[model samples]
Target: MALFFANGATFATWGIHIPTIRERFGLSDAALSLAMFAVAGGAILVMGRLGRQVARLGSARVSMLSGVLFALATGIILLMPSFAALLGLLVLFGIANAGFDVAMNAQAATVEAAHAHPIMSMLHGMFSLGGMAGAALGGWVLSLGVPPEMHVTAVALLTAATALLTRPLLLPDAIPIDNASTTDGQHRRMLLVLGTLAFLGLLGEGAMYDWSTIYMRDIAGAAAASASAGYAVFSGGMALARFGGDAMRKRLGAPRLLTWSAWLAFVGMLLAVALPRPWSALLGFGLMGVGAANMVPVFLVTAARLPGVAPAEAIANVARFAYVGMLLGPVIIGAVSHASNLRAGLGVIAISMGVIALCGARSIRPAPAEY
Candidate 1:
């Protein structure tokens, strides 16, 4: 839940400030895209190693430390005097984000295992909820004429408080070593397939997060500040859906739920691309959120249950692949938009979700009987 709040706050920070950064740096659209890509690059370059570090140091310790870094990096980005310095700060934020992502998910998986219930989806939902609050707060702050430094500082303080509050709820290093041994031989192949599906799913998610507002403002003719509401609505719907997803998953099972989610996302993306009105486009984005809400959590659970790998190792491996998707999604969207229109570019994202819906079942095996 704390992680989710942090997720919300982080994106809210970025979404509300992106325009400010663009103005401050006198950045062209392409240049802004490249700077955003730099953040992804940092995450891609460091996530695998950071995952290993988390495994060695323990999720609780890593999460606490990463939270501090996350807060500090946000502060630096707000205070940096030059574009180059800001870019460097983003890199640090990216690294901290990567570590936070892996450690939190790893911790969640442990908690879920102990409870013998579906909790991962709800945890992610909390993140979406946090994101909504953060985005709203950011928009409010900007509207109230709060300076970037003060706004970001407020976010940093909130992040630190959440981290400390939730620190006690996270499990210690108590996961069974035997669980790691299950991913041997054929298990490795299964894990690879699950990881690939997760990668594709995450790519779609990243595109939505990084590009939805750009699409709205550029294609739908929304005002700069109003455009962010597209993501806010999408994220709000996702949070609500995720809060209910665990119960839904209990009724439908992971395989069926994922299949439906893919279809929903595909249809939602198509509508978003086809819709001409801003309101309709925002609704489409919301539908996409509903579709995507459960897929990642379901895949992460599958990864954790793979044979011959510890839950931590499995999460690390799969998370590395997911980061690739997250990194590529926005960059591809930006590149495509530079070459064509943003709408035409986002159409590819819809197609990718369609393909995932078509193939996701084949990519994941049923959870092991033991699980």
Candidate 2:
């Protein structure tokens, strides 16, 4: 979870500095977006293979190495002298992020089994909390006229220290699935359903993270500092709700919790799109965080517990879908934004979440009693 926190902090810090980098490089908006896509493209190419690599290297080693590499790659971007160097650093950052993502999720699944409880949501919650801190701190520091390089350096040091501190908690053991744990054809169908739902959930999340602030500032008439607050509030609400989601899941069950979460997120998106006020938009973002808090974690836990697939295989499959969503979500939103208004683009996200709420329950049935 601390690793998740550090990863979020690093990503958010970089995101806060994107405009600065673009201005420094004299990049057109299209060029900057393409550079972002280059990063995602790198992750898409490597995430699956990296998951298998984690199985061989063990989670602890992969997590530590990826964390260190991520920090180093992000720090290198601070010194980029041209657009080409920045793009290269972004690609490297993507590789580090994809590797770390697989390693950490694999580790979290193992930890959840050991604890015999719902913990993944809380772990991811810490990531959201860290993102909130990073964005807020980055904005605050930038407002004070600090150089982007200094900000990136401070975040890098913090990431390295945190990664070292948490290295011991990630164990080296793999999931020991019994050979008898085979499933019928139904399990394959279920896996497909769950993967699709995960894709949609991640799509909504990625869209919000990548575009919400821009929508607020450019369309909703928010100041730069106030625009950033949308992301901070969204992340903060997500973190807080995820910390408590285990109890909620126990009380509500996965099916109902997911249904309600999707509905809430749908409404939140609608609120943000419909309300023109900046504060209203921030409130909508908060609702979005609360509603999305546990959806992905629940999907992860559910996928791992499917009848036939080993925990590792299930995680890898679902993770592949997640990576696709993370890669495609922003691009799709950007395309829509270019063709129409940003609000119309975000409306598609709202509609997608609504579809997930309506259809996702059928994709993940409860496991049989004897499994």
Candidate 3:
């Protein structure tokens, strides 16, 4: 959990600084989106191979090492002198961040399986908590006139220390060769459906993560320090909702939960675009946080348990799709915003959420009653 928290914090720190980074680079929205694509491109490239690495090396070892690498990469990104240099470094950042993310989630899934129960949502809740902390802290420091270099350095040190201390506490990977076998046709179809849902859910999430602060700054007319407040509030809402997600899932079931969440997200996005006031935008983002909190976790948990599919393979496939959405999200928004406006681009997100609401229920099949 500490590792998850650290990873989330590290990622959030980077996210909160994006507006500053954009200003430093003097990047237009399209140019910034292109740079952002490098981050996702790197993650997608590495995610395809991550399952094999986790299988060979074990999740515990990979998580620790990747945590270190993730911290190092975050620390170095702000030091890039030019736009081209930032783009290249962001790719490295993406690779390291993706490695850490996969290894940690793989560990979480292993832990959940050992207990024979649902705890994925709680584990993910810890991540949202970390994001909340990171965004709030980054905003506070930036408001105090701290440099991005100093902010990232402090985060790097903290995450590195957290990883070292928590490595010993993580569960070991125990996915067996039998359970890791290739999938059959029906299984493949199910995996694809689940992956598609995850892709859509995470597409919205990625947009919020990468662009919320910018949106707050540009569209909501927020001051520089307070730009991240909306993001912080968003993370807080996600954390609170995810902490309760397990109970909600038990009551609501995954399919129904996902369906409603998408509707919730659609309403939230509509509010943001319709009002465009700082307070209203923050409220909308918070509602978005609530709506999006459990979608990926539910998808990942469902994938991991799909009959005939290896847990690692299922996770990797779904994660790949999710990351693809995440990568394309900012670029898509950037392109739209460049051609039209930010509100129009965000309307695209609202439509995507509506599609998810309409289609999300089809992904989950009735589970067999078994031990």
Ranking by TM-score: 1, 2, 3
Error of 2 at 71 (Å): 1.6
State which candidate, 1 or 2, has the greater TM-score. 1
Clashes of each: 11, 0, 0
| Candidate 1 lDDT for residue 151 | 90
Cα-based lDDT for every prediction:
0.79, 0.80, 0.83
Question: Distance (Å) between predicted and true CA of 170, model 2?
Answer: 2.2
297, model 3: CA deviation in Å?
Answer: 0.6
Quote model 3's TM-score: 0.83
lDDT of 1 by residue, 157-217 (tens): 8787777777877787545554544456777777677778877888888889889998889
Which of 1 and 2 is ahead in lDDT? 2
Largest lDDT belongs to which candidate?
3
Q: Of the candidates numbered 2 and 3, which has the greater TM-score value?
A: 2
Task: Name the top TM-score candidate.
Answer: 1
Q: TM-score per candidate, in order?
A: 0.86, 0.86, 0.83
Residue 320 displacement (Å), model 3: 1.5
Displacement of residue 132 (Cα, Å) in model 1 is 1.5
